[model samples]
Target: MFGSFITMLTGIRILKNINKSLLGIIKYEKPIDKGIEIAGYDYDSVQDIFYSNMNAWQRNMGYSRLYDEASAPFGMIVDCEPIYFKYNNRIWLIELWKGQYDLNTGCEVGVYTAEKPILNLPEVYKYMFYNCASDEDRLTISLSLKKNGKTLFALDDKHWWLAGFKLGEYSEPSELVMYLNITLKDEEMCSSFVEAIKKIGYEENKEFIVNGNTVGLTFDKPHTTQPITRTEQTDKIIQMKNKLLCDKYNDITRVYSNLTDKINAIQKQAPEIYSEIVDKAVLRKYLRSMKNTETE
Candidate 1:
């Protein structure tokens, strides 16, 4: 009972969210002919700076649960190699480049994080079906990841409306197992989306597996062509829509301001003309005088 309690406290826990800003790539070494170097602890002066930044994160968050595992993949950051680091037990990919790499004048580094947590993989899977407009979606009650890094999504036998998730064919060896929900409106749209993925260098069945409902993809390392996330796309569309609305409102305000300024100028410079046009009583008198003058 004591061991069980301890496990509950230390075992895998779902993260509420990941702060990308907390994970930044710092350049510690200049590029040489071979490659740039990620500052190792042995490099005392530079290591201080690296740890100084890392300390900020450590002070803010708790230690990672998977920090000590032999297969955890965290190591000294190095150039030209993709390092898999565990940040709070969530896998992240950090890649460093040498100056020899095209389009880069100096050493550069990049850090990529999973869009969703591993604990949330099942939920992400269900969301995919919902995004697909599938009549149903679900995971089995006994959902578990296999030693071979695979899992199944099954629906209720009696209740078709309940939800259904299925495991499709897979090809790559992946440390991370997850599903991508691509819910395009129609076949043409789906084809375009698939093409977009392919254009970024993903192959069908080898790098990704597709089925009637779910699209299964794995992330052993950072992917060149990432799965299209529905939430991100929606957020982008909303942002763009907001920007356009704001622009339109500003344009309308500017035109209204220009007209208001012209009216005020007339009122100041030509009070009679302004009153004749604007004031009801003055305009009525002006009209009556004009009529009498025309009659004479």
Candidate 2:
């Protein structure tokens, strides 16, 4: 019976590993460069290059403030100054439009001069998430799960720099917004997504009406009006210490229970060879210690 129980637990552990492998793989890849740094490019030169290479589509229709000009596809919308930069002598422009993507009225797009191929879709995302911190400089990193059950890395068409400074009543600090579409197919992906967000201390606001399958998210840097204190650190240390103690206690309890069952069986068969090494006093002592720790 003991051997069978061990085999069952081992099988369960294997199944969990298999499940994790079946889910989509997420990779964080870094950028490449020569001796020169590409990130700290001059702003005016980048903007001028981007303006010189604008396609007729963007030039004729793309106004600076479409929302305020009363030509916005969406209702009154927030605005942020477009970002431009040059990397490896290539000019790039990032524009946020009131109606950029097909589904969402607002979207952000990064354009380049196309003299040489710029970073692919995935590389663009890695640069945003791993390299950049400014809202104006980063793209929304999202996971797309379509109705057909295909999962892929997705980016929001609209990127708002600080969600457009002082737009309406949103007075929060600078932050980034990401969107996930058609998320119903995979439970593991959704669970991991939420846990990953929590691990980074990002708050989720669910007031947008994107659709049942779609999820909109934003993450801001942690803030506190109060000054930092030693008491806060002490509290965190205490909480972690208690958690470690509790985990150890639970593991010990499980082993003790299994051993006790075996001891009882052996005692019934041959009391001379097998006897109770543990008594009520020992158990009581352990329980009292745990209680004392909790009180402390």
Q: Judged by TM-score, which candidate is best?
A: 1
Model 2, span 1-296: residue lDDT tens = 44334334443543464344223221212111100012111112211111111122122222221112221111122222232333343333333322111111122233222122355442332122111123333333332212123221233332212111110111111222323332322344344434434444445554222334343542122222111111345434533433443333333334433433433444355442221111111211121111111112
- lDDT for each candidate structure: 0.26, 0.26
Candidate 2 TM-score, C-alpha based: 0.19
Tell me model 2's lDDT, rounded to 2 decimals. Answer: 0.26
Against the true structure, what is every candidate's RMSD?
30.1, 27.5
Q: Which window of 10 residues has the lowest lDDT sum in candidate 2?
A: 30-39
Query: lDDT for model 1, on a 0 to 1 scale?
Result: 0.26
Tens digits of lDDT, candidate 1, 1-296 = 44233223332221111112112221212111001112111112321111111211122221121211111111101113232323333333333222111110112222333334445543232111111011222111111122145343211121111111111111121322333333333454345445545554557887666554334433334444221221244434433433443333333334433434533554455444333222211111111111111112
Residue pairs with backbone atoms closer than 3 Å in model 1 (clashes): 137-163, 137-164, 138-164, 153-165
